[model samples]
Each structure stands twice: as structure tokens, then as C-alpha cells.
Target: RSIHVDSPPSVPSLTTSYVHGTSSVSLLYQTVGQRLDSTVQRWPEREAVVCVQDGIRRTFSQFQQDVDKAAAGLLALGLRPGDRLGVWGPNMYEWILFQFATAKAGIILVSLNTAYQANEVEFALKKVQNATDVAFKSHSLTSLTQS
Candidate 1:
């Protein structure tokens, strides 16, 4: 026996549709750091991040604290406002941590493609004049910085 299904009716496209987004509410322009801080302040105990693969989880307050520590470490390494920093790796807790850290430090983040080869990484680093590179596990920070 075979199951028969009827197709759903198609809806007509709206005549007012445009390439640009139209919203009734006004946009709120806020930096990532500001948003993070606000979120932590409003919901300190709320779960902010969870990495099941890594067996890691953190609340908004905990995430913010770690971000602050990472930002301070970057600052101690001589990173200043507008300095170029590169993050080259896959999606991980460390990647998320560095993302917020860079924003908090006011450093420009140059995301090096995870699929990039050695030459491509070198080219990207040169193009962006990246002063520091953050990697994970096999790609140590010392090795990346040296490169």
C-alpha cells in the first residue's frame, strides 16, 4: 500500500516586498560589549552558553567574567584599541570567548578561515597585519604568534 498526500496551496508574494528590511520598531545601536554587559546585568543567572561536546556550560555572569579575563589577557599582551588580532580555528568555547574578548578590548578581529592552508593563513595575516593569533589544541598560541 502507498500513501497519497495532497500538496498545500501556495501563497502569493506581497507586492510591497523590498530588498531592504522594514520594521516598525527603531533599531538599537549598541556594541557587542555593551550588549553582553547589559545581558549579564539583567540576567546574571541565565544560561548564556553551553558546549555539550566540551562538557562546558556557563551562565551569563560566568560568561561575562571569563570574557573579561580573556580581554585582560589580550590587553596584557600589548593589544590596544584598533589593533588587529586574528582568530583561526573551528567553533569552540574558546572561539566564543575570544570573540567577546576582542570586542571588549576594542581590537579588530580578523577571522582566518578554518579551511585555509598554511599559505592562505600567511597571506591573511599579512593582509590584516594581525599582531596576534588565537588557536586551539594543536594550534598553540605561541606557535601562531611566532608565525
Candidate 2:
């Protein structure tokens, strides 16, 4: 005797199952000190960074401590997750610190052109309407300004 075969039917759906978007780097730590705890694993006994212009040299362990301090300072200033931080200036050691701190504290960063004049700075500030605090190279000629 021969067996009969049946074909399976296909169905279509309107909604798509998956989508791709910009990738995110996670800096969340279990506690404020956890960031320091994790860095030792990857950068143990390494010269993590040095800033010649500022005469600053720090090993990985030292760098991790500085980051923790900066993160703590930001938290003390009332910054919290989902807050926007705007940084505009020539890249420097402090600039890098602010970037890492913002990420670790879950704040969004908006970079503004340091060359922008007062009028331009106003425009950029308006563009990132949610920015709560601004970090810059010089307090007087900083990149962040309100419109």
C-alpha cells in the first residue's frame, strides 16, 4: 500500500518580528563601586591612560578611582539616569572622564562643536532640549549654552 502526502499551508502576518537599531554600550554596575571592581579584571597592572597636556598619568587602578569619584560627584549634583549631559570642547582628559561618567551614570551625552560662537551654541543647545548640565574645557568659553 502507498501512503498519501499533504502539503503544509503558509500564513503571512502584518507585523515584523525583528528590527535593528543603533547599538548601546552598557556601563551599569550593581553598585556605585562596581565599576571600579570590574575594571581591575580587564586592565589590571596596565598603564590605562596618560594625558601629556595636563601632566596627568594614571594607571588602570587609578583611572578607575577617578571615574568613580567623578560618577559620585555627578550623582551628588542631582544627575540621575535618563538625564541629558551636553559636552562641547577640545578633547581632553576631563572630556574623556565626563564621557565615561555620563555613560556609567546612565545619562545621554550630546557633543557640541567647540568652535561654535555664541549664536551657534544657542542653536545647538536648543537642538538638545533635554540637556540638564553642560561640561566644557573653559567655564567662560564653554561649548554648552542655553538659548
Candidate 3:
């Protein structure tokens, strides 16, 4: 299948160097949840995630279960598909779970850097708020931040 556009851009890009591959392979249009489900079906017992700091490990099946639960929780909190959810945390197993959870929940995940100060986070939240409707009615970042 061709991935090229039917028509080129009306405006000319004088410095752009666009290239399309001539390979016979077609792209797999699937979400992260779909791919995870496929992997679990193929290799349920295979190791999917491991956090060195916490010594946390999980197989594909376990990972899928946790991600599904988190996704459900997000939905329960009134976050629907296309809703924006901002996640602020450091690199941890929980963060990975939310990464997959957001994708599975069909909510856009706005990853806030762990190093971001309170002011920066406020600015980011405001910035995204201006562009899209961010859901924070029930799912607050209070627990994730320093008290």
C-alpha cells in the first residue's frame, strides 16, 4: 500500500528534502494496546518490563492486566477517548503502566518532566489547557508531587 499523499503541498518547501521509501512493506496501523494484546497472546509469559531501582518485573500477561485496570480507572474517572491527561512523574514502573494505560484509554498523555518545578508544571498545564480540554476533576497530580 502507498503511504504517499494524493497531492503535494500547495506551498513550496525550497529547503525540504522529502523522501519516500520504495520498499514493499506496508505499515502496521495499530495502537499500543493492540500491539500489547498481540504480544501477550504470542508470549504471555515473556518478560515485558523490569525496573532496576525497584526490582519490579512483569510478564506480558501481567503487564496487560495492570494496564487494562489503569485504563479502566481512567475511564471511571470520567476521562473519555480524546481527552487530555497530564502525567507528571519520574521514570518508574508506575510511569510505564500509565504510559500504556493512557494509550489504551484513548486519552492523550501529556508527559510532564519529573524535573519540572511547580511553576513550570503550572505553565505546561495552562499551555495545554489553552489548546485542549484537560480532565483533572478527579485525577489530581497532588499525590504525585511533593507536599
Candidate 4:
């Protein structure tokens, strides 16, 4: 047996059940690239990243420099702003750099699951490529594996 309510679905009332993200701290409206730049300026020499297994370490200044170069490299590869690039890999330092560089270059970086096969990657890339509404631009699908 089914019972029906007379009234249509009503919005949740803002009482004990409703909680919001709004807080006393004012929001900082800025992009990741912008925040990175500011942090680099404030503490260029401070340690920004460290990967013991990879034997990699970078200060804020170094990280910013590398990110800039990486972003430029992406543009040089013929990927214009809004073009989709896929990066598939296990956790590594390069992932961090790509995260910032993509934002700087304005290229949309698609995170491909490390478990995805080649066909899956191709399908995902094609979806983004089609959305771009342009003739086939260069597809940069780089994969990295942890040692």
C-alpha cells in the first residue's frame, strides 16, 4: 500500500538540520596561481614541498619557477587556454606542479584515473576535445609511474 501527501515537496527548513559554510572568517577570492605567487613572494626561501622517496625538495621560489616553466611548456606544445590535457599517474611531485601550471596556462587539466586503460583515456580526451569546439589541437596525455 502507498500513501500520498497532499502538498508538493517542500524545501528543507533552515533550523537544526541546516548548517552552512558561512563563517566568521571572510573568504579569500583568488585563484591557486595567485595564491601561490603571493606565498612565494612572502616566503620564497621557505620549504614548499618535499618528497623523500623521490629525493625531491623545493622551496616556494623554486616551485613557482618550475610551475611557470611547466605552464609555458604546455602552451608551447600548442595547447591553448581551455584545451584539455590529461595527466595520469600515482602521487608524485610533478602532480603538484601540474595542478598549478594548468591553472596558470588556463588549460583544463583532466585527471585520468591511474587504473584507466588506454581506451578509457582516449574516450575521456575525445569528450573534452569535442567540447573545445576546435579543429584537433595537440593532445598531451602524459603518464607517470612511481618507482
- Return the top candidate by lDDT: 1
lDDT of 4 at 34: 91
Give the candidates in order of TM-score, highest first: 1, 3, 4, 2
lDDT of each prediction vs. the true structure? 0.80, 0.65, 0.75, 0.71
Candidate 1 per-residue lDDT, tens place, 52-73, comes to 7767788999898888888888
lDDT (Cα, tens digit) per residue for candidate 4, span 64-111: 888888788777767888877777766677777777888988887788
**RMSD (CA, angstroms), candidate 1:** 9.8
Query: What's each prediction's TM-score?
Result: 0.75, 0.64, 0.72, 0.69
Off by over 4 Å in 2: 1-37, 137-147
Q: Is candidate 1 or candidate 3 better by TM-score?
A: 1
- Candidate 2 residue lDDT tens string, 59-135: 87877766667767777778888888777767677777777767777777777778888898788778768656564
- How high a TM-score does candidate 3 get? 0.72
Provide the lDDT at 123 for model 1. 97
lDDT of 1: 0.80
lDDT of 3 by residue, 1-147 (tens): 346555545555566556444435556699999999999999999999988886778999989888888788778778888888887666777778888988998988888887888899889888777223232233232232212
Candidate 2's displacement at residue 146, Å, is 27
- Predicted structure 4: clash tally: 0
> By descending lDDT, how would the candidates be arranged?
1, 3, 4, 2
